[model samples]
Target: MKLKLNAISKSFGPVKANSNINLTVDNGEILGLLGENGAGKTTLMNILTGLYKPDSGTILIDNQLKEFQNPREANKSGVGMVHQHFMLVPVFSVTENIILGTEPTTRFNKIDLKTATDKVVKISSEYKLDVDPNALIEKLPVGIQQRVEIIKILLRNAEILIFDEPTAVLTPQEVTEFFEIIKSLKKTGKAIIFITHKLHEVLEICDRINVLRRGKIVGEAFPTKTNNKKLAELMVGRTVKLRTSRRKMEKGKELLKVNNLSILSDKKEPILTNIDLVLHQNEILGIAGVQGNGQTEFIEALTGLRKASTGKIVYFGKECINITPRKIHALGIRHIPEDRQKQGLIGDFSLIENIILNTYYEKDFSNNLKLNWLNAKKEARRIINQYDVRTNSEDISANKLSGGNQQKLLIGREMSRSINLLIASQPTRGVDVGSIEYIHSQIIKARNKGIGVILNSTELEEIIALSDRIIVFYEGKIIAEFPSNSDPKIIGLAMAGVK
Candidate 1:
């Protein structure tokens, strides 16, 4: 199948999400869609998959101009998209999920479960997806769940598959497996569109790369013709500093101490067990692990979001185990939560409102319970300009910003306030390369200024680059500890619970 998007444009009020876009994906070729967050990548894909109608464009599938009213219509036309967030029902079996929208029915109008399972099995085997037909999505690992998504697309007989940040949640090992699957799909002559923030992955997997900046196609490159630095520059329109300058500094007072910390899940299973760590001013303590191996719980405990069942959290010589999150923040502790959508920013609040979330009650932002909207906007403008938030107005809702820019807003709001300690989780999870570089530099600058930091990230390279010391977590326990200069292979082994 050959998919062509010609002169696509979309707008919401004054925000032009996509503008005059032209793209093509040929059969048996992987077209890499490179863009920063909110760079209209999602909007363009939505248009192609029939989620949103393009304001001024024509979609040509195999040179036939067609208008699709909905995703099912696009599916019938052989277009399918695997979203960044999985759309599977947690309780449903893999077979159920794959056959959800377009089920095979008998004359009696009943779902033919056996036929669905058989088709799923055939596709799984053909693509080496390694998915069990009867496996529940809730019980499957993230990587396996992604395979289920692929199987779903394949079952729909989609000739053109769109993957949006498909590997964002997968571990390094699972990434290799996914690459193999992409290779198999290419061999099957499928036209694939891979959307991701990871530059190296694009260079590794793509046949051709197109860069988008501010909703316009700015540049195109082949893997052999372009490098990470060039792609990053194209994406952000600037020379990016790819490395963080984390310099050695004099160790100051002990900032925090977690002794024998333990947490139990709702199932009464230990999620974090006997974790011990120390953070000192002027240092970054990076906690590295595969997702769900107690890193979330540990961060929650430290931030006062969750209580530790059996342990002590000592901060500046005072016990802070059961303190309220607000109290912790009052004590100069700031947190950049892992889930930005749910915890970091309120979707309905304006950019100015969200920027002053922590300090709205202060004299500058408010006076005797009345908000000073003018002052709030000024502060918002300052942060946006300083942090390079890609929004034109402070009145715009934080929800309107791109994922990367939302992160930047949060970092700006959090770091600008007076802080004694910073606990950042997945600091650059969905951000682009340029934003990642800037955020890393900010963290390093914080550490250099004698503020203690606790960094939790699934990316090992990030941990190695920013951490002065590193600890690996597995099965709710600290399996290994190493200096930042330690071999990554040993760290990888520790992350997999192979002590």
Candidate 2:
């Protein structure tokens, strides 16, 4: 027992983020902290890392009571946290960013770049995290930035590491490399607390697993003794069928057609190049790829958020290129944008306002003559009930909801529209176990009802499981297409542009 948390509790107003949470991690062991979004996982980790002060609890480090006032104090106590988003300064060199606060100084208080670079390199080599200390943070890929963060902690000689959703942005190969680094860290006598919603990775890397639900620890198990299905049941409090089941489609006529499409990014490079694809009614076509491979740009072009340089987009047998976003919505197309915070919903608006956002001008929820707040509230309540969006009140602001609930609200709102076609991108990203299952079912239901569906996700399992036909995107080009029943490793290889 290297670290033990006893009866930790925290709350925000009436909402308890964590309640009597008890957890333990042994030295040199990797423990998985499994939970859905807003299940108190992040809050507990923040308390451990000194970002939050627990309302009631005692933290025992080596059986001694300890409290951290801030992150630096936690660092001094041999605990470090790497957040889901990289925190490096883009323009700074790796060494500079690593030693930003804890600078190597002389008598004059000037930064000693040589000493900092030497320490960074030594830590990187010891952890097998090969990074150029002098390279600019922005010039490095996301994986290398992650390595720099880890090296920062190791350079301070941290004995315990906390990683929050570390592989969410990584490619499959990069995920493998990250696992190797984690294994190496464990061998170096460091206790690691791994936090993620990815069950496969938990089974692959963790020795013991802790499941948190509704701000409390619910269950514990050894990975070798339990499977994903069982762990999912414990986390969700129900026996959830993890796989997505879709019937063989009776393909209808084409609903959307893209011919010779090319899109230039703001940097004036071809982010989508000569792409041609079609989605037929009653079928789901999934585009699978690693991040930065042009999937975002492709989705933007189809959703009327970006313009195609030279191409023809025919939605419902009518030309649609260069149309405004409002025009696209009026044409009976519902798009769930990839970045929920930026594009999916208005963070400052109430749930009712967000639910009727694109269609509020219509006569159903509102009219050209007058607005109907009552009907809009009624419709919002319907979506909230149907989508299982857990909230105390629909009057709450959209940004106040958890990530999973926000995603659910977005999906429910879009699916409420009687659209001819639907475009969903990274729809299940950061959602919890139960919400993921429900969202997948809803998408399949929409396809079964004769609406053409275009699915984009970096998760290979999601693409493989939900798509009838899967296309691999590489550098803004469709490299290959495969049936959904193909082996997952095959698609994994395709996503890496190996095929």
Candidate 3:
């Protein structure tokens, strides 16, 4: 299969997401698309998958020009996409989800369950995908769920595959396994477009790479022809120091301490148990774990968003449980919540309003019950500039911006407060490469200024990069701890509870 995108251009309102981008993928090749956050990688891929029609472009499949009006049309034309987020039904079995919409049928239009299951099993074994046909998707791990998504594409007989940030949520071992599977697909003569921000993976797996910056293809290189430093420079269009610059710190006393933290669900089942942790001023403590492994419970308990049945949360030598969220906020604890849209920002509120959301009572932005719009706008603009938030109007509603921009706004809003302790969970998730660097630097800067930082993220690179010390959370317990220079493999094993 050969895919060619010629002069592809797409725009959303004033933003030119893809500006005359031209690229090609030959048969049995993995062409990597590298870009900073807000680059046109996702936009271009969306056009290829028929999610968005390019304002102007031509797509050629096997030297024949084609037009895709919808995803079904793209699928029928032998194109398929596996998104960063899987699209499997939770309650349905793998076979059921795969055969949906185009079930195997007889003359009477009756479903053929046995044939579907048999095909799924055969395809799984052939590609080494190893998914169980009868297993429910909700019961599978993140990696297995990803495989099911891939299997869905295979079942459609997709010759061209587009993988968007595929390894963002996998363990180190699972990533290795996935790479092998991708290689197998390549050997089977499938054209693959691999989209990711990780420079090292581009070097490891991709055959050739194209760099996109601000809606244009800036550079192209083969893996063997370039190094990470050069690729990073190309992606950002500047020399980027990959490591954080932090000043040596004289450690202060513990500002936040959690001992024997335990949480029981509404049904009286234990969600978290026997968790002990501490955060000291001038130290960045990273908690590394897979998602849904009690990280949410631990952070929610400390931030006063959720109640824990049994736990001792001491903040600045005072117990924090049973305290209201307002009281917790008043105590100088800033939380950059995990789910930004749900917990961090009010979607209907203007940027100015969201900026002063928790601190509106201050005399600078408000007096008594009245909000000074001028002062609020001034604050919002300051945050926008300081945080490099890309927005044309401060009066625009919070929901209008992209995901990365939304994250930037939340981080800026939270970090502006006079904070003694900061709880940042998945702080840079889904953010672009440049914003990711900025966020990491800010976290380190806060630590340098003697603020106790509790960083929790699923990204192992982030965990290893920004942490002064790291702890692994598994099954609601602190399963392992390591110092700054710990090996990645060691920490990875601990993430899976392998002591």
Winning model by TM-score = 1
All-Cα superposition RMSD per candidate: 2.4, 2.9, 3.3
Highest lDDT against the true fold, candidate? 1
Can you write out model 1's per-residue Cα lDDT over 182-282, one digit (the tens) per residue? 99999989999999999999999999999998899998899999999999999988998877666677778999999999999888988988989889999
lDDT of each: 0.90, 0.88, 0.87
Model 1: residues >4 Å from true position, as ranges? 91-96, 103-118, 133-136, 358-368
Worst-scoring 10-residue span by lDDT in model 1: 242-251
TM-score of each: 0.92, 0.90, 0.88
The digit string of per-residue lDDT tens for model 3 on 312-371 reads 999888888768888988888899997787699998999999999899988887788888
RMSD of 2: 2.9
Candidate 2 residue lDDT tens string, 29-123: 99999987678887888899899999999888888888999999888888888886567899999999999899989778888999899998888
- What TM-score does candidate 1 reach? 0.92
C-alpha displacement of 499 in model 3, angstroms? 4.7
